[model samples]
Target: MSNSARILIVDVEPHIRRLLHGTLTRADYRVTEAGSARQAMAEIEANAPDVVLLDLGLPDRDGLELLPLIQQKSKAAVLIVSARDATDEKVAALDLGAIDYVTKPFDTEELLARVRVALRSRLVADGGRASIEAGDVSIDLVQRRIHKKGEEVHLTPKEFAVVAELARFPGRVITHDKLLAAVWPRDYERHIEYLRVIVRNIRQKLEDDATVPAIIVNELGVGYRLMGVAG
Candidate 1:
């Protein structure tokens, strides 16, 4: 049962770690466990796994405090499997690069699903998966094409490039400046209107409720994030 994906499960509870280790191993994933933040750091250094299941309450330090360190150590996707589910904590964890947050007393199916999504999202980010299809929308990277319900949805090169760049960083925010630079190239220093127009067009085509989007979410004054779409 050897899948290509490797996961690191970090928790102080031996029982919980064993349960997760068993489940993931059975699902054909390579699994490793760490009982403390220090140990987790060492594990991360030793071999960067594809995903990390992290608990916020660590014996040595709060998981939030170590988030940056962990991210720096590996390119693995981070999923918070902590007991804390407060709105503030969820927001902060997301802000700090966590792909998803699962609270303690969690359902096994839900946790597994979140882990799957995180892994899939990471694949898209790392360019392992180049195209995405959800419902009537499809984004093709090789051809630089988008389709809606089997029909070609034409977008300006700028608009298509912007969407492609944002799509690469699933569940992560790409700031306005970053988008501008990636899409507009040399004109990024001056043109801001281009980004706004392109984003508006993307929302109109992809969203059922442009006012309250379900796919591309505007992060206020920041930039944008691509949310998981049902495929």
Candidate 2:
């Protein structure tokens, strides 16, 4: 875990900001704190952190509005750390291009894990280090390639698209509809099997221990996500 991976912690609470600052700093992650949307935008413009931990309730403007602006300015991954755990809120954040969301009173370890996964995928996007290797598996989104140990692995066009899409976002739980639309077309949004079969294949190829997959994981009825990476 390199301190080079920077994260912006946006929270209205002073204690929350302080706790995150201390926790992240001790874990060797470069962290920037912002208490308002205005300050968050400013910090994002100046430093361009790799990932943003955003709170929906901001003092000035709605944090959700800043999502598009943040994405437009920089390719930083935004994770909404809000107390709003409603289904609509989660879906809205995901649809608006946020990578993930964590409600208040969340587990610190889970939050850090999501941050790590988001940073890893962002690293791939930034072309810093494109390939991710874990155990015997490797995923290369740039080259549209995958390999197990030293051997090359082949996949169909649709299969590759699904794998690439999920792996690109790492810990982000992309919904089944979202995956279908991105891979197939807007019309195939209801085809759940399209995601399921491809996911099964990807797991079989990448997971050294298929029974306990480390590369890609399921989110039950929600969607699939690529997990287990460092921030």
Candidate 3:
């Protein structure tokens, strides 16, 4: 809700830019507008915004191609605001590290909600905190300790590493490759069974019922997500 949060809107249409600028300005966000991918890249280099609203259709290049560049330039969360409705496009963007996507003619309220969520995720990721809390689970990042319901929950070092990585982006899905690389940097090709075991152990320690997990939810063939803090 801070007016200091910077948002960059990248779209080729003048009317769309004006509409988004007006809406976001009224909502107390500092917004920067870019009409092309080239301009967006330049803005990112000059000063990275907190969040980026990118449209796939650009006069210079495909917006998807610019995703990695943007990510490399800054820690800004990218939200695709394209008119393209193809499922493949959405999947591609999400896989490429986009936090979320919204099609054209999007409802203002929903868009704002998504932006808030993205901002929250960024804050959690960027914050230099010694601990994190979600649901009934609390993790001490410094001590590498975990507790559930105020009771100590033991976890192996590997298990703790996996949980810590997922806890950084609560409510957001982290791809298997990313998780794997984070936990097993040397053995990138390690079988999925290793991750499965760690996840199961985490669930048993944190969830009331491992069979019906509430803390860590698995995305079939994709990755895992830690449920967000309760509202």
Candidate 4:
């Protein structure tokens, strides 16, 4: 395996593991395979990968049960790759700290793209600098500054905090509760309107058009995601 980026495929099916290994290897990612939750844990402890493609139907244990354990042991990003397509299952995985979810029979290009996004998020999280860039927008966490096209873009402190939080995870969705708890004091955690207002203000300053936004997109009723960012 090359050192470009390590990806662990946690699927019980040998053919599925082989398929993912080939695809990821061709794309320059080092691949590891785990046929069960126990093996997955061992692999994670022995060598933490940059991203984990987890299948929920592990033989030794339910994959969701291992999500937090994985997070506790390593900084690798968890991306659920399962055949279970229930909305509740997706929400449960995301709520339990999985960064992204991809159902079985997924498109190759889409899966690759999601993997790229997950890797980018992991890189940014581990990079130690809280700064991130998306297209023309640049966020400086240390300086608490934002610039668009090399020009400074002024934002309220609250608005800047919101953007900064979103930038930390880049392309991943930050749920409404997570953003609220992160940005506001405990007493204001339920104030979803505050998030909405701050997001609106951020778009007005950072995006070309707030109406048809391209940078920060709403995940319907769930949360918001920072789009088009690279690691």
User: Candidate 2: deviation at residue 29, Å?
Assistant: 0.4
Minimum summed lDDT over a 10-residue window in model 3 is located at: 122-131
My TM-score estimates for the predictions, one after another, are: 0.56, 0.55, 0.55, 0.56
List candidate 2 segments past 4 Å from native: 1-3, 127-231
Cα-lDDT of candidate 1:
0.80
Each candidate: what lDDT?
A: 0.80, 0.78, 0.82, 0.84
Better of 2 and 4 by lDDT: 4
Clashing residue pairs for model 3: none
Q: How much does each candidate deviate from the true structure in C-alpha RMSD? A: 12.1, 13.5, 12.3, 13.1
Question: For candidate 4, lDDT tens digit of each residue in 1-231?
Answer: 222457899999999999899898888777889999999998987666778999999998999999999999888999999999999999999999898999998887888899888876775665434567888898765445689999988887567767867887789898998888656745646698989999998899889888999999999999999997867
For residue 184, give model 1's deviation from the true position in Å.
36
Candidate 3 lDDT tens digits, 1-231 = 221457899999999999999988888787899999889998886655878999999999899999999998888889999999999999999999999999998998899888877776665666534467878898765445688889988777678768867877767888887788766755745678888988988887888889998889999999999884554
Tens-place lDDT per residue, model 1, 1-231, is 222367999999999998889888877677999999999999887666778999999999999988899888787899999888799999999999999999988888888888888877776667645577645577765345688778887777667767777767656789988898766545525477778878898888877778887778889899998776443
RMSD of 2: 13.5
Runs of candidate 1 exceeding 4 Å displacement:
130-231
Residues 1-231 of candidate 2 have per-residue lDDT tens digits of: 321357899999999999888887877777999999889989987776778999999999888787888898777889898989899989988899898888888888888888877876676665445566645667765444678877988877677767766766667888888788756754735588867888788777777877798777788999887777545
